[model samples]
Target: ALYYDNGTFFTKDLPKFQPYEQQANFEYEERFKRTEGKAPSGSARKCHFCLHRLNAGMLPACVTTCPCGAMYFGDKNNPKGLAMQLLAFNRGIRLKVSQGTEPRVYYLTSEVGTADNLKACLACHGA
Candidate 1:
């Protein structure tokens, strides 16, 4: 489930969309060892929520580097956490709810006017 949500499957051959050379750089090697260890080619790769930083009592880079202060990360089970408070206050919604994936990420959206407006937006986005 975690892989499906945030993983990227890399191939030796270039991909069709936004193709780029899959070369071994310093960061690539470091991240590979840090996350998916000893995986074969074409395996899924994803950051494991920066486990090294978490173990060192630091927040993930995404949450720390968010310039707008829109991202929050913490224990979801903690009632006093800012993430939970924002979720409750904004009535956050998870994507693909019918799929039963139970995604860990939550999104907050602003009012898009009437139901007709929402339908139009979804239709345009092919949601």
Candidate 2:
């Protein structure tokens, strides 16, 4: 059913944002230049869902590096697809629903106590 549903056009620049903090982000840029001997492209860059990486038959950076197995990806049609099953089971919700931009990315609702490594710091601190 989902496979037959036509999806919107996907592109690298659909989502855009202004440059973030100079100190925080620029630190990464500086490190990249020091380690890799090349300057980063610009002051800021947005996530493109790792289009080039996907094209190269590799997983996205976030999904690959996410700790605690939080990220999921794969073909939705496959019965064994983790991403599809998680979404189909209603454990995940789409972001920016009102914008009509249906993204494949999903944030799982079933997972609990992820913040601060499941520690109730706020509750204990009486905040």
Candidate 3:
């Protein structure tokens, strides 16, 4: 199951393009940022969006914990070419494409008007 999968909360560098203003809430946190100790504090991963954020060539915590191998992450650019392939596979269906904050994490299928999948993922991830 997908966890911490919110388009807004769990991805790396959001695209910085026009009409896609980044929401303040989706801003990344630093690894060393102080948390307020709330059950759902937003500061835990602020570092995820820092200018220095980059793929370490390993899975993130949730990805590593996934038993079903449903999640995949990699460069949309470069020799990886995985993202290009995915886009080709889903040419017509819509994703969360307008967030201006282009999240590197993408959901493979369409969840166009349904919050169920997104909610389920968040609950699974404890977000």
TM-score of each: 0.52, 0.49, 0.39
| Deviation in Å, model 2, residue 124 alpha carbon | 20
Scored against the true structure, residue 94 in model 3 reaches a CA lDDT of 41
- Tens digits of per-residue lDDT, candidate 2, 1-127, equal 0111232122324463223311222332233221122224443455666776777899878788755455678876796787777777656677898898877667666555557533443444345
Which lDDT value does model 1 have at 41? Answer: 27
Q: Over the stretch 2-35, how does candidate 1's per-residue lDDT look in tens digits?
A: 1333344343244442322233323332533213
Candidate 2 vs candidate 3: the lDDT winner is 2
lDDT of 1 at 63: 78
Local lDDT at 14 for model 1: 46
Note the residue pairs that clash in candidate 2: none
Error of 1 at 82 (Å): 1.0
Q: Which residue pairs in candidate 3 collide?
A: 15-102, 20-100, 28-46, 29-46, 29-47, 30-46, 30-47
- Model 1 quality (TM-score): 0.52
